[model samples]
Structures are given as C-alpha cells and as structure tokens.
Target chain A: MSSRREILDLLRENARYTTEDIARQTDFSVEEVAAAIEDFEEAGIVRGYQAVVDWGAVETEDERVRATVELNVALDRETNYGDIADRIAKFPEVTSLRLVSGDYDFDLEVEGDSMREVSHFISDKIAPIPEITQTVTHYIMESYKEQGMEFGDRDDDDRLSVSP
Target chain B: MTFEPADRVDQVPPSGIRRFFELAEEMDDIISLGVGEPDFTAPWAAREAAIASLERGRTSYTANRGKRELRERIARFEADKHELPYDPDEEILVTAGASEGLDLAFRALMNPGDAIAVVQPSYVSYVPDAIFAGAAVVDVPTRSEDEFKLTRDVLESSGAAEADALVYCYPNNPTGATMTGDELAEVAAFCREHDLVVFADEIYADLTYEHEHTSIATLPGMRERTIVFNGFSKAFAMTGFRLGYAMGPPEAIEAMNRIHQYTMLSAPTTAQYAAIEALDSCWEEVQEMTSQYDRRRKYVLSRFEDMGIDCFEAAGAFYAFPKCPWDDADEFAEALLQEEGVAVVPGSAFGEGGSGHLRVSYATGLPDLKEAMSRMESFLE
Candidate 1:
C-alpha cells in the first residue's frame, strides 16, 4: 500500500541511508523496500541520487547565472501549450518548466555562463517561436533555502536527548 | 556476599515494551510503529534560540528551579492556558524530562508501603517509578468498554479507593483515551472525598483534538492537592531537548526541586533557552503538527473500520489501540514482525488490561502507516 512516491520522497531526503533504515522509516519490509526501489529504477521514477552542490562556496571562478523566464503564450487550437512545452523542455539550458496559474502561462528556469549568454539564448532562440508572445526573465541573486533544505547550515540535531 | 540493591527494585519486572525495542535493535529493515517519540523536530524559533545561546557560550547551568524567565513564562502560560495561577518562584520545578519529573514526584511524595492507584493501558512509567520509590502500585483498569475513563465506579471496583495517591494520564499513551472536563470533575470529587493526592500527567495536553484538554488542577478544591506535569516534548516536538516541569503547591514543588537538584542538577541550559523561545512563539507550529496528526489519525481509524477490525477512536494523543482477536498479544506482535517485517507494541506492554490488543503510533509518515494497514489486513485474512 505504500506509494512509489513516498519511497521516492525518502530517497530524496537522504539517499545514503540503508534499505533497512528506509524500511524502518517507511513501514516497509527490507525486501519490499528493495523491490519498490528496483521498480522505481526500472520505471524511471528515480533517475539518480546526487548531492546538491553550492558552486559559489567551492568554486574559485564560478560565473554561472540562473534566471526564471516566464512566458506568456498563445495556445494553438491543436495541442494547447503541449507542443510548446515539449519544445521548451528540449532546451539543454532549461532546468525547470511548469505551466503556472499566474500572469504567465509557462515558467522556465534557464542557466548560463553569464547574463549576456542567457539574454542571447532568450532573444535568439526563444523569441523565434511563433506561438510565444512575451518573455520576462528574473535573475536569481542568491539562495537561502532550496528544496526544503537550508544551505550552509551546521548539524544541530543529534544532541540533548535523555529519553525518547 | 555480593553488595545487594533494594529488594523492591528487583521485585518489579522490566517494562514489557523494553524487550521488543531491544529485539528490534539486533536486526535491521523492520518498519517500526512502536516508537513513542514525535516525528517532528522542535520548531525553528526554538532551535534558533538554542543555536544563538551556544554561540554566546551559555552552557552553564541555571538555578536549581530553572531560569527565572522560563519559570515566569510557564507561570503566565499556566494561568492563561489552564486558568490555574501558580507562583513562578515557589511552585514549579523544571526537570530533565517528564520521566525525571515523574521520578522526582514519586520519590518526594511516597513513603514505604504507601499505595498509588495507577490507571492501566496508561503511560509505561508510573508503576515502576512508584515501586522504586517504595510504594505499592494498585492497578486501576480503565476498561476499553468504558472508552478508557477512570470513573469513581472503576476506581472503587479496582480497589483504587484504598490508595493514598493516584497517577493519571489523559490523552493517554498506548490507548489515546481522553477524559472530558465533566468526566474529570467526577474524579476530582472522588479524590477529594477519599483524601487522595492526584498526580496529573498532562504531557499530551496540547496534542488534544476536537476537545480542549481539562487540567484537574483547575477543578474546585483540587489545586492544592494536585501535582500537574507537562513538557515541551510532545507539543513543541522537543523530546531531545530534555525539559519538562512539575507544577503544584509550594511544599510539593520544594520537595521535587530538592530531588531534581541532586539528580539532574538542572536541565541543559541551551535547552532551557530553546524552551523559553518555543513557549513564546511555537503555538502556530504546534497547531500545524497537531492538524497533521489529526489527518493521519482519521485516516488510520478509517482504514481499520474498512478492514472490519475493532478500533476505539481516539480524540487525544497519537496512538490507536485496537482489539485483536488473537489470544496472545505478544504472539501476535511477534508473528506480525516475523511474517511481514512490521513492528508494533503489543497492548500487554501497557498493562495486563491491554492484553489481546495492539498499539500503533500514527507519528510515522502516512505512506508507511498505510503500508502497515495493508500488511495487517493481509495477515488477518
């Protein structure tokens, strides 16, 4: 009865934990957890587990700039936004895409080596799309929290317990 | 002859729940529904205060009674939340945990051969703590048929009327049973008539659902004789912080504080600061966590009903005690673990009255809880 999504959530939180530990947390047997994880791997529900990196902290000459580009689109009568969403998703620079319910019809997160490179990609590549109307790009200044995790934080949880 | 400890200590059995946990430790890959701790962490404001205090190097102990500001806030909190006014300086002793608070209260109040009536299917600490303090524990079974209320009739029938003091836990552990104010007023009347001191463990007070928790101390003529225990562990999700407090008349608080000073010295200073911050601003977090638990509770109960298992709907705490048709609780618990890799505490661990039942904690994630239910259904079928 445990959902594939729940198992994925646990792996997302801490992938290094053992199958036994995951089972203890998720109420699945080790065999069941192992099987579900195997199914996830086969079905592509999980691609890979990797550490989230902060290049600003480690890299000496990091020049990467990322921006969220909101697109106001005119949906065609045939495939309303699907064709455009597919085309946008195909871009290597696009990190995220969502059909949002705000002033914009689609949201795309794009990254580049510099601001100029990003603007060039938008104006040269994206502006040519016939169904698109307007594009507003917002550059991310810094990230304090991402994916429900606080960055650059000290480990503070394992101390001060006398009982359960 | 070897140096010997007190015979009474040897006479009492180790907690039935302890054996299962020890067994669980020897293996891996078991999904545990037996853990009593909350799944949430202490809220951010509280954690921030603790971090700030550590950076400021405030690691030294506070006064034996605890920090003045924390005690003052607790006093105000009591008055505001429970309508029971307590003098901050004279009537509260902060302990390392509710466990220590219970230990201190028992040692401070019990005389050898004194009798303490403890409700069964209750928290695990009361009986052994009383025994260690040289008191005889009288079992007062709060039958499931009665929805787990310890009424005057239940007390009298179980010989609890003869006891000198009573230990009561509402929003009770294991069973998740709670008593309404009208129900507790009857207990207040009975204790008054029988001249019994009441030890009220309200640790789960803030976790109450659908009904407000009623502290017996606020009942007429009960404040002077009732010793109330509460802590941040359950509501504020600060179990690891190790801070809890006992509130009572000045004499009882003084006795508990004397024991507290000797054994624990003081609760960790960083934790005290964290607790003070939590006390001030963690109500919103408490509400969010409580509502999440409510959703899980309803879901679990509905799952049980769908499976046609008999489960008593709980309005307090995070546990659900369901009656199983199995003849032996320990056997069922063991079989479930062996066959399905799912672990739950047998009801017999709570007390003899809890035999033939099982206690499941909804403090776990929803997916796993659902998995456990399916496992149970398959096992039962």
Candidate 2:
C-alpha cells in the first residue's frame, strides 16, 4: 500500500491523527511521515484541515446561518468563468464555491449571522459583479450531516473493558 | 458451603488476567490494549441476514452438525482460501465458537492419561481445555529466538513429538507469530512420523499480514490426521454471534458432533444464518478489516521500536509481544496501569515461556494506542 495514500486516508478520517500516529500506522518513520505531509502541503495537494462544526448546536446571541446561492452568470468573451468564480471565491463568507454543471454556472455556499445578512451579502457583493446576471438564494434550514460526519449521535465504542 | 468442586474444574486456575481485569474495572479512563478479539463489528450484510432470519422466525436450533448451507459455504471458504477440501456433509461440525470447537476436539480425541502436546505462550484456552478432556498437557515451548514459531526441532527437542496429539495455533495469540507453508510442511512431516493427531486452531488465519495462510491439512498426508478449527469471531468480527466450525476426517468430525449434539445442540441459528451471509458476501469486508488490522499491527510494532523495546516482528494477528525492560512483566504491567492508566496483558499471563514480556493489542483506535505508547514510555522512564 502507498504510504502517502495511507497517511492521507487517516488524516481524512480524523485530522487529529498526528504525524507520529501516521508514522506508526503506516510503518513509516516519523521523519518520513512528516516529510510526506510537507511534500503534500508544498504541492498544494493538502490545502488545509478544517473542523466540521455544527453551528446550530452552539447557543449564542448571534446564531450563524448558512445558505446556498445559485449563480447564473453570462460571461463576456474577455472574462471566463474562472475570473468570475475567483472573484466570488475571495469573499470570506463563501465557505465553498463550485463551478457546477447544469442550470447554475456556480454553486456557492455562504454563511452569515442571519438569513437577511446572507441575502444582503448576495445582493450587495455577488449581484454587483460584472459577469453575474441572475442569483437565487436558498437559506439552509438545518444540517443533519456535513463533510461525511453526522451531526446527531455518533457511534460509541461499546466493547468490554477487557477480554481474552 | 463446605462442598468441594470437581477436580477437573478446581485444578485449573481461572484466567490469569482475572485480577488485572478487576483492577482495570476499578480505574477511570484506562486505555486497554488487552482485548484478544477484533474491534470491528460484523459486516452490515451479516447483521442484516441475522435480523432477517429473526424476522422470518427462523430462530429454532440448527442441525447438530450445523445448517448444511452454512457447512457448504465453510467448505468452499476452506477450499478457496486454504486449499483444504472438506466435505460439507461429512467433515464439518459447527460449534458455538472456536473455543467450543477446541473443547469439543479435545474431548473427542483425548482419553485419560493421554498426553497432548501444546505450544506454550499460546492461547489461554488450550491448556485448560486439555485438562478438561482428561488429558495431560505436555508443554512444547516455542523459543523466542525463533519468533515463537513451533519448528520441527522444537517439537523434537521437547517431548511433544512423542505425545498422543498436538495442538497448534498460528498467527499465534499474544505473540502474533505465524509459519510459512514450508515451515508448516516441516511440522506436518514430524506429525506424520509420530502419528500424532493434530488439532490446528487457525482462528487468526485470515488476519496474517505478510503472507497467505497455509493450513496444515493442505500439506500432503496430513488431512486425515488434522482437525482444523476456525471461526467468524476474529476473521468476520462475529465474536458475539458465537459461530465456529471444525473440519477434519469424517470419523473425527462425527465424534465431535456426537458430543456437540448433546452439549450445545446446535450453534445458534441466528449466528449460523449470519455466518452463511458472511461467507457468501462478506469477503470484501473481511479483506478491508484485515487491511485495517495490518496497519495497526505495523503501528504498534513501530511504537515499540521507537521505545527501544525488543519486539519480534509480528507477521500476523493484531498483537505485539515486546520484551519488558523490568524484572517482572506482571509488576511492570500493574504499576503502569496504576500510574499511567494504560492496560496491557503481562506476557506471563500466556504461559511460562511468555514471562518478562507484554502482549500489547492494537485493536484500539490510533489515538488511544498513541496515548498508551506515550504512557508506557513514561512508565519505562
């Protein structure tokens, strides 16, 4: 098995699995595991590790809300989808932006304190873009699962304390 | 209150780790590396099959020899994976678990005063089971110098070659050592020369990491003399289901079933149904789990190496037996558990030959293993 692939899979499953842990799991030296991860980072293959959070689970004065904004852009000959997508991706509110196929040219997930805030960001920031022609914003009602992790009850290890 | 228990029950002591288990039970947040079974659950398809069986009200006892369909699948599995062809109709007898199958084999083969040669530093059940069968256990200690493998010389030098029968387990428990086909062929030759009835406990056969497992029954002239015990407990992660089978000559299997019909009546119908599904469609899941275990095996060994502990390379099974730096592994394990909250089985718990070592299981998730290693390093320091 490929050591890099093994390390990648472990990190993908649980990012908290450290380099030392990866070394042990992969039979790679600590230095080798560190170097491989460094190579991955340097090559831009591993962009970043972000925690999958459930914002709704936390009680706060400013409850965070997320929405998916479908953008139908009419790109000029001079400005391609990359230029328009890049402009949309630069916004701090856009958690994920994809140049999707089908009816919408781009699917962007935006997060804010409220639905009105997200709507304003789309109208104020996204709608004013030169290539942007039409926008449809749908506020996310609830998130039961995200990034392959379920938001509800996680499976607990129910094995015995010890056994032969 | 003054009544005495039977000699057979009283003579054999309880499991060596009973005290350790009690101690661990009292402690809080202890990372245990002591379990001898796989951490994974049975595959979804298997569970579904059992549930489906229950829904269909097929909960009655199976045939004493087991459900024929399950036996047929076992036959195919044995033939495909180990190259040992068994007649599902005549040669396979399903029992509660490999533990029960082993006990049945011991009872069927050994008479009073019969000496059964057993490889030491082996599974905990073998010696006691031998005793229960009214047999004497002749210890055949596999040397650590040979990575705990039972070589022909080991058998010859020890009194095992002269014994009435021999019990062999590889991808060994506590040690995680295994033998190659050629190595097993050598032992097979020894068994042939001695006319020894061989009871092969290959419960961990599918979990071998380095090479494919070779059943002793596959070697020439050995099938008639060997009864191979295997189960879904380890390989298919069906420990709680309690499904296992013994494959051997018709007469031996019949002997085992004769006892089984009266004792267990049948392996649980639900487990039999589940095992059928497991053998039918769970090969891919089994392979996935085996790969996971292989990774953990490497990880545990690597940690021991970093700690400067002299651990033999465990080519199979999900354990690492590292030589303890302290004078007594039992003391070391106790102190480590009390102070650092990491639980590992002292090697002495396995047998006399397992003294001054520790069997660290890697069935836990990586995080706990890492925490335990760090705690062990501190304990060593």
Candidate 3:
C-alpha cells in the first residue's frame, strides 16, 4: 500500500525522522509524507517503529541474554510451520521469527534478562508444542554487528575541520 | 627579504576567505557547512592500493605525463561515462589535482592580453589562475532565474563572444547548477563560432542528480577544442591524494605536459596507483556517494523552502546557494557564525556574481545539517 518506497527505506533506517525530515529527504511534501504513512499504517504495511537499542551497552540493574532457538517440527498437511510459528511467536521473549531454509525448520531469536530465564522459556513454552519435534538453542556471547551497522567501536570522521 | 614578487602575483588578490578560514579554525564546536569536498573517506580499495604501492616501494617518479595504466583507465572512463574518446598516450596528462590542471590549461593556452571568458559564482581559483596566465577575464555571470546555467545569450550579453578562450564548469561549485545536453550544445556552438579553446572543468561530473552529465567535448566539433579537467578528489573522495587529469587534443595536452615536466615533474606515484585502483573498482562507491548527495541536496532545498529562503534548485553539486535574507551576505555569515556557531561560506567569497547569497554545503552529515538548520532558524528569528 505504500507507494513511496524511499520514505519506507528512510524510516526503516531511522524511524525517529519526522514527517518533515522524511519529506525533505525524499521527493514528497509534508502532507504527502503524513498521508503516505497514514496509508501504510491503515493497510498494515507498516506495523510499528522500534528503536535499534544496544541493550548490552546500557548499564542497568538487569543485564539481558539473547539466543537463537532453532525449532524443527513435523507438520500434517493442514497444520503448517505457520501454526507452530504462531504459537512460538506468542512468547514475549521471541524477538524475531523466520521460517528459514536448510537444516532448521523455523528460526526464533529469543531474549530475556538472564540465561536461565531464556532457557526456561525455551524448554517450558516452546518444547510443549506438539508439532515441534526438536529445539536447539544457541546462546549468543557477543554481537559485533547488528541491523547492517557495527555495534562496538566505529571509525570516526577524520576529515579536516574545513577545506575548499 | 626585499625581493619583489612577480607582476602577475600582484595583479591577483589573495584568497578572500583565508581570514575567515582562520577564524573558523580557532572557534570551538562550530558546525561547518563550508566544505567543498566530499565527506566520505577515500574508498578502501583506493587506500589499500596506495598502501600496497608504498609497501612494494614503488617510490620512483612516474613518466612526466603520468603512469600509462592510469591514463589508459582515464581514457576508458571518459569514453564510457562522457562519450569522449582520447588517445591515452597523447591526450591525457595527470596533474596534482584539478586545480593544477586548471592552472596548466590557463598557462598553456593563453597569451598576454588574450581574453578568457570565465563563468562567475565559480570555484575560487578560476579568475586568478587566468590572470596569473596573463589572460584578461570576462566575468560572465549566470543568474538564479536561469538556474545559474550559462547559455549563448548570456555569453553574447557579457561580451564573452569576443574572448580568446572560455573557462567553464558545470555542476558548478558554489551554485550547483547544471546544463542539459541541449543547453551545452548552445554553448558548444558559441565556442565553435568564436574559435575559443574550451577549458571545461568537469570535476563534479559524477555528482549530477537530475540527468546524466553531458560533457561539452562530446558535442559536434567540440572534442578538438575542449580541454576537460577531472579528478578523484570530489568523485572518489581522494582529495588528500591530490590526483587529477586533463584530456584534450594532442597539441594542447603536450604543451601542458611541457610545463608540468619543468614544474611538477609528475604527480605522486602512490596517488597514481590509488587512482588506478579507484578507476578500476570504485565506481560503485562513487554512485553510492552521488545518491547520498542527491538525498541531502533534496533535504537542504526543502529546508530552504520551509524557511522561506529563496534558493534555486541545486540540480548537481552538493552545495546550495540561497539568497541572503539580510542586506549583506558577508555580515550575515559573520553574524550567524558568531551568534549560532555555524560556519558557512559567504557567497562573495566565490565571486561578485555570487554576492548577496550564502553557499550552504550539504557535504556534512544529516544530523549536523539538521542542527545547523535549527540554529539558523533561531538566528533568523
């Protein structure tokens, strides 16, 4: 439903950009930007905007843990991977879910405050699903990159303060 | 200590903004939108090639013209991009930068009292370089109404019709104006009729947004008359490397190399290697940078509109020239810097043709541009 692909791309990069900013950066007017975004939300093309937070970088009372949980399921023709995916997605810890190719049937990325919490959720909530035959959890020790951006130290702009 | 400088040196003024640059340099936390170069670093491929060349100890001076490989690549590049063909061995001479190429062209082609028609609101160097080469400058100013493009009519009115040669730039530095193919054809026809040798500065060729850049050399009968200047500084983000080249008819290029051999000897050897790699692999990077510049150009133009500043659409380069809302652009720039801590080049720094305007560069990051705009908004209020 969103005809303005550039606006979507810009919003995907940084959702914090205002309608005026998006309009300025793209070929749309302010009203057009607002209306296109409205149309996207109405058509369910754009679900929501979220910040790309580096939670590990933040010092807080509760440090978080993350893991990729591979779910292998044997499905009857009527109940597809979508059914098992739907049940697994209901858990708040599952940050991302994808029906991927290769050895894995479904890939689920889960996050929780502690390793124990994440492990417990995988065993208690996900394993109980009848269609899910196997669950393999791999805990992530570090993130060097994320969302097409580097996570840790980045290169500084080393150009001179001014030049012709 | 009492030695006098040459007469040509006295004829030209020192750069207008050295004091302004010194002031900005001494300021604290000033957001600068005054730069005329790309913000991106040189592509990794180019940097790696330079490092590799140094590591290999390829430190010797190249042939007086330049490295054969680099010239071949430049010839192929021009043929592919601008549709102009030149013999690499005979027609191309790599120089320190486009600035050097400009100087070399001026010195090689112009004689004393010969008039060189120069388009104003241009780069800071053109007029002085012409004067240094002993050419009378005819300032042919392009107006905002014409999108700052040079047409045959403007040429006729400005008396450039009588000049011995023409110095022209497109995707112009301060104004960011560009001409269409048909528009360039008119200028080409004018140059052809006047028998003027064309020194076309196409350094901003890749930064064009609205349409594919059309080189003046590609027009009918222009190839023989046009001396094209291009470089890696703006396109490949290789300003520090100081690599640029000139392409033209064999006789003109040979004359340029004659001066180059006595003075520069050759461009940097490592930079030549870097330029080879840049031409070989950095085109995608150039395209990426161009797209980013286009987006920023749109953002700046839109912001100017919202702020009710009169700015012509910058169809090409990364800078935007907006008419100063205040009476004097220089005073406005100084006041803005002192009050809001934002630095922009006053338009008069370019030429009298650019007076009453401010050259706002969008070469900085978007966040800085946004912040600068907000500060400018406050200053205006």
Candidate 4:
C-alpha cells in the first residue's frame, strides 16, 4: 500500500494519534510518515492535525465559539476592495477571508474573545474601509460539525485509498 | 447580486511593522527587539491555575462578557490601583486582549466621517483601527523634549476636542512614554468640556518606573466619559494567554458588551480563571519584574548615550525609543540586523514623527541586552 493510504487508514481509525505512533503502526519509517503528512498538507486533503483534548477533561468550560463576518464591498472600487480584503486577511484576529456573493462581497472568519470584539472589527476595522460599504457580522453560538468530523463506524475489513 | 468583472476585489498594502517583524523572524542568529510581545511567561501561578481549571474540567463557553469572578477581580484591581470604580456586571468587560478592547471601543463609539485623535508614534493598531471604523484619525505629534507625553496643547492643536473620541495609550507601546496625573487631568478636563469620549489604553500602566499609574477615570467627571483598556499581557507576562478588560460608562460598556456577546460569546474560560489568580496572587512578582525592567531600562539608556545615540529615559514599559544615528530608521534597523544580528523595529512602523528613531525592547535578560549593546557599539563603530 502507498504511504498515503496507510496513513489515512491509521488516521481514520485514530485521528488523534501522533505521527510517530501512526508510522509505527503502519510499518513505515518516521521520515516517510512525515513526508506523507507533508504531501497530505500540500494537497489540502489534510487541513491540519489537532489534539482533541476533551473539553470535559481539560475544563468544564463552554466550547470555543466561532464568528463570521460578512463584508459588503463596492462594485466600482474593485482595486480598493482587494486591497481591503488583503489587509483584513493579515489581521491576527482574522482566521479566514473568502470572496463570496449575494448582498455581501466577502465572508470572514474572526476569532476573538467576544462578539463586541468581532463587531468592533466589522464596524471599526472592516466597514470603515473606503471600499467596504456595509457589513453584517454573525456570531456562531454553537457548531454541530466543526473542523469537519465524519460520522459512522469504520469498515475494518475494507482497504481504503487516501488521495493526496 | 451578480457583479461586473471589474468589481471584484483589491489587496491592501502590508502593515509595515508586521512586515518588518516577519523579516526579523526569518533571519537566523537574530537578536530581535522587533516584536512587542512580553518576554516572560504568564506567571507560573496563573498558568498553573489555568492547568488546574483544565484538570477540573472547566472548559465550557463562558458568559458573553466573561466570567463574573474575572470581571469582579478586574473591577477591584482597577479601583485599588487607579481609583476607578466600575461595576463588574455593567461597566467592565473581559476581552481577548487590549487589542480587541480598542477595536470594540472604536466600533461601539465611532461612525463614518467621525474624527478620532491619536498620539503620534503611538501603537500601530490605533491608526488602522480608527481608519477601519470609518473615522478620520488626527495624529497629535509629541516631541522627544516632552518625553512624547500627550499634552493639552498638542491635543487642542490637533483639534482632538472636536473628534468623536480621543484614543490615548499611556506607558505607551514603542515609546515607553507615560502621562502624569496633572497631564491626564488636563486632557480629561478638555475632553469633558468638548464632550469627547476618552478611550484610554493603559495596558502598560503597571510597568511604570518613576511614578504610579493613574487612570483618567480617576479624575472627577472623567470617569463618566473615559473607557479604560487594560490587560494581563504586559505586567503579568501573559501575552499568550490573551486576557484583558475594558471599563467605562454603563451605557457604553453595555453597547460594547452586546457586540462582544454576539461576536465572541466569551473570552477563553480557562484563561479567565487564570486571570483571576493573576490579579489576586501576582502583585509582588509584578513589582519585582518591574524593578528588573527599570534596571534594564537604565542600562539600555546608558548604552544609547555611550553610543552617542540620543534617547530619552523611558519612565514606563520595557522599550527604549532611541533616535537612530542614521537618517533612515528602516535602513538602520536592517543594517543592524544583517551586520550585527541585532533586530530593532524602525520607529516609522509606529507612525509619523517616529522616523529616524528605533524601538528597542529591553524584555530580554540583562546579559543578552549587554551583548546586544556590545554588538550595537561594534556595528556603529
């Protein structure tokens, strides 16, 4: 089996396993496992690896919340819009910025302490740009599917190929 | 709406300061003073508290504003330290950091075409943030002779009283400059007369060397209009922990908190718990650290003087903004980094009036600072 397939099978069974552990289990060298991981990363197939520390075990606090910012840009000021988007993208507070359609010109994912901080970005940072005319910010109260979790029991007998 | 091809988007210019820091990060064997991050870890007690919270399974979404205990502790801290009384329930808010607090203030208070006054050579975030809020930022330039302290004359001359809000940061970033009680009073008086909302960023207040940190809200009549931003990042070396708080009028706090509630939901729960312990158990450690910073500040100043590089004695914070011996601060900083493995941020990265100056943080240990000074001297020679 290709290294990619082997890694994927290991991850599918245990997404939280360390690279070294995965390599050992899959009978691959650590460097090979690392290379396979990098390939997965480059292909955008494997976005990231996170330690899924149980919220219950780590702390009984509420789960982390996510917020989205909808930005409205001017049609005539295309150059200015890109400039604005690029600038917004660079902010440490902003997680992602995507050019979108409908009433808004773009959608942004902002991570911060509270909605006030997010609205401040929308009002004080995002909306005030010469290119940005309007903005509507939505705070995510909860997430049913976050970081893309797949549901269902794994088929132990079937060999699955992982594409990079 | 389906748009015309010409109406797509544009990319903005890179933040000059951020760009410089990124470059500094790439170089091997670089002794960087480029970053504004605090050097020390979040106090061990604070970190331990956070870990304890994690062990206790306290990781859930907190109240939108923050945990009640954290807010209450912040209120107590402010009152005891600065004589600013705030109601934890209505007048105080916990934020990701002072950065977010400033952003929230601008969003809550500013409207398009409204003007805001900022002290020049201030933190880079103020200008961009004000601009983003649709407010025209009027820069009030402070001079080296004045120790870069914001004065009533400069504030009035800049037409800050006419602005929708006045954004002030003391024990300021980059410069390590602070305002005296009288100076703050004068500005407060002026703002009161002009009906200007005062957004005070006092993140570095606890790091003052010469005197105690005083809040504008401490002045009579000022508390009603002043919104103070402070956090644990600097004094407690909790930058990575990302905990801060804002205090202001009930109405204004409510507005900002509403936005915060809708957007952030709450600050990290574990961090908030840790912050409570930080405020409660960490004053002695803070004093010790501040004393050490003062010593470093003196050493760095003497080094600048020895090098014939004019620098004002910083009375607060851990940065020394020294006049560069060269004409262009950017070029000088680059040369220092490339030739001597020393990294300092160009003053221009902060704002206008910052050219020909460099901000060198003394957050590193005494030995490293001594070595950097030696490297700097050799490079200059």
Docking class of 4: incorrect
- Which window of 10 residues has the lowest lDDT sum in candidate 3 chain B? B14-23
Model 1 chain B is weakest, by summed lDDT over 10 consecutive residues, at B22-31
Q: Give lDDT for model 4.
A: 0.79
Q: How much is the lDDT of residue B60 in candidate 4?
A: 98
Q: What is the TM-score of each candidate against the true structure?
A: 0.77, 0.88, 0.89, 0.68
Which residue pairs clash in candidate 2?
A24-B299
Candidate 2 docking class: medium
Q: What is the lDDT of candidate 2?
A: 0.89
Candidate 2 segments whose C-alpha is farther than 4 A from its true place: A67-112, A116-145, B1-3
Candidate 3 Cα outliers beyond 4 Å, as residue runs: A1-3, A69-84, A99-108, A119-138, A152-162, B1-4, B49-64
Query: For candidate 1, lDDT tens digit of each residue in B310-365?
Result: 88878888888988758888898888887887788888888857888888888876
lDDT score at residue A61, model 3, on the 0-100 scale: 88
Ranking 1 against 4 by DockQ, winner: 1
Candidate 4 lDDT at A122 equals: 69
Worst 10 residues of 2 chain B by lDDT: B362-371
lDDT of 4 by residue, A1-164 (tens): 23468577556545765665555334466798888878988998888666533222336354444578777776563476577677889888888899877777789998766666766766777777777777777887644444444223322311111000
Query: Model 2 residue A94 lDDT?
Result: 97
Over the stretch B64-162, how does candidate 2's per-residue lDDT look in tens digits? 999999999999999988898999999999999999999999998789989999987989999999989999989998888998998988999888877
